[model samples]
Target: MSNYSIKAISNASNDAIIQLKELNISFGITEKTSETLPNPAELFLGSFAACILKNVERFSGLMQFGYKKAELLVNAVRLENPPRMDELTYELTIYTQDEKLNSTLLKKNIEKFGTIYNTVKQTCKISGNIIVHKNV
Candidate 1:
């Protein structure tokens, strides 16, 4: 059996917060309109972004890419009626002092083995692009 548990709290104002007991994190949610709290769907996308970033950081070290900086942008589209995610797009920019390393390989390492990418890809359609810049 898994030793992880999820817990959360919310206010009358519709603000929601959750904690991952295993990871010891407390995250809050707020609505875009303020009429209600941020929906679970939003959190899902946010979690995916976090997961991918974490994996990239770990993989970068193992791959010895000499990264100077990294940034990611994530966007999602939600379906109507069912109010579910239809598509997700990610763009990652990596800065490194070495230009000889193929950016394509770096992108493949992140997208193929990233925990979040694997998890999301199993359930939904996912696609992304990566850009590497010579660090100044």
Candidate 2:
């Protein structure tokens, strides 16, 4: 197993930022009273969305799929008692000129082989729907 570590620091006004080393990315977090940025929980949801989006694009290329445009939307509901994400839903729309593309196959490739999807699906209720938009 590969192990990783990162660091986060809080600024003077209670604004905090965490840097992800593997990806060389950083995100800011803060509270309404402390700062204007979103909290950590919201960042988690955004991270999940970003991870899936990146994976889907890579998978689409590997599967030799024709696409004109693509978009993804992610929503997550957090539980109040235990402070955990309870339900997560995703909607992915793919636009392409080819009508013979098997959406089911694309979805299977994503759900079955996507490293991030598989990892997150194990702990949370992860569900996604795929839609194909035919080009005119």
State each model's CA lDDT, in order. 0.72, 0.74
TM-score, structure 1 vs. true:
0.77
lDDT tens digits, residues 1-136, model 1? Answer: 3355688887664456676755533334544444444456667877788877786678767776567777888889888877677789998887877655567776787778777678788766888888887754
**Candidate 2 wrongly placed segments (more than 4 Å):** 1-3, 21-29, 33-36
> The CA-based lDDT of model 1 is what?
0.72
lDDT of 2: 0.74
lDDT for residue 43 in candidate 1, whole number 0-100: 70
Off by over 4 Å in 1: 1-3, 21-39
The candidate 1 region of ten consecutive residues with least summed lDDT is: 24-33
Best by TM-score: 2
**Positional deviation of 102 in candidate 2, in angstroms?**
2.0
At residue 19, candidate 1 shows an lDDT of 65
Error of 2 at 14 (Å): 2.1
